[model samples]
Target chain A: MIGFISEKLTGYLLKRETICQEEYEIYLFGMAQFFRKILVDATVVFLGILFGKAWEMIIFLIAFRVIRIYAGGYHAVTPFGCYLLTILMLFMVLLSLHFISWNLSILTAVWIFASVLILALAPIEVENRPIEEAERIYYKRKVRVFWILENIAILLCMVLHLRMGAESIVLAQATLGMALLCEKWIHGDVRND
Target chain B: MRKGVVKMVLKKVAYHEAEKSAKIICGWFFYQPKLPNAVKKLRKF
Candidate 1:
């Protein structure tokens, strides 16, 4: 399943590069990335439910999805600001986990919180000056490859989670967080596309 | 004798047209900063 998804996403990304307008292509890619995260969360929930860990799954889904949505919508905040917000959110989730007491609930809560913090703090610094034409082309190509690899890694993580265990999902999320950090350094800005 | 020359010309024209069409299709998908170069290259072909 992971290989299939990875191939499909790569084909789709390449097709978009070949056939779509640049702005629209960026938008499509961004939307696709967002949906991919949602799918991962959903898969985690599905597996959790299958294992009779419904409550843990539900909490993980809600916390992870909500923060993802929020992060997608807002990127103007500085890394420090984002870090603070994520830490606060982490505290809330931890408190909730204490009340629920589901299997691995606390661990899952910590994972979600740490994931958000990493994503939020991923350093992105855009310049006020316009980029040179040559630089622009270079950056575009760089971003394209970065996203392709990032998506493929994400799909692989999902497959591993399905076959291995919940720990794989946490590892996958961590990998994604690292990828985002890398992207931030490469693009020098948090603005999607 | 003129027919062969005309056919060759037509093939070249067709190839250029196809290249143009492909570039246009791809350009519309994203904000390509190198579009002018891409278009110029397409026209050359």
Candidate 2:
């Protein structure tokens, strides 16, 4: 029943008229909701790992799966640039945590949660104009930023893997692939537009 | 009246296409088309 409602809402929101006049508040609210959802999922995963609770891992996976669907279905999905930024931030925290001795994993988890909160509450403006030029430029800049952050995150993860012989690099790739696949599924093709 | 509205939409679409083409051409020369001006022209038409 909830799925049906979500599908309907997704359809309604993706329709042209429904998107023509979105207010800034609406965009902010949407972004906040998206970020909140991600934070909850990440917390679940982190806590699950900390407590060695298999159930929490299951719950985290389910939560991310839902996020994947939601993002793909909604045209107002979380911007890739922001997603990449969050991933890079997570990578940095994880790497830095390795150098510290005092329950650094907990600190990394906290950092991830805090970053999620900050992104959720960040002041961002969306130009909801109908002009293609403005939209194109906006997306172009966004894609560029995403590209840079993604590359840096990937590189850092690889570096850490080389130094520590950890599987975190593979985990990063899997996570990134899932995100890209989800985005592609939602957007009907992932080749930039 | 609905037909007129459709025609207006089509006109705007055409304007957008032309503007995109102009931008592409300008991009080859390391320039960007004036988007605000293009949008203004579109409104004028």
Fnat, model by model in order, equals 0.00, 0.00
Predicted candidate 2 versus true structure: per-residue lDDT over A17-90, tens digit per residue: 43333222232223333334455457545644664543424432442232222122112323343444444434
Q: Please give, for residues B1-45, the per-residue lDDT of candidate 1 as tens digits.
A: 675564444334433433433222111111112223333344321
Q: Model 2: how far is A64 from its true place, Å?
A: 11
> Clashing residue pairs in candidate 2, if any?
A72-A186
Give the alpha-carbon lDDT of every model: 0.39, 0.35
Model 1: how far is A184 from its true place, Å? 15
In model 2 chain A, which range of ten residues has the least summed lDDT? Answer: A121-130
What are the models' TM-scores? Answer: 0.26, 0.28
Candidate 1, position B28, lDDT: 14
Predicted candidate 1 versus true structure: per-residue lDDT over A1-193, tens digit per residue: 4334433543554454532443333333333333333454455556556555555555444433322321222222232343344434334433443454434564456456645644454222233113334544444454345434433543464466532234333433443354345446566443455
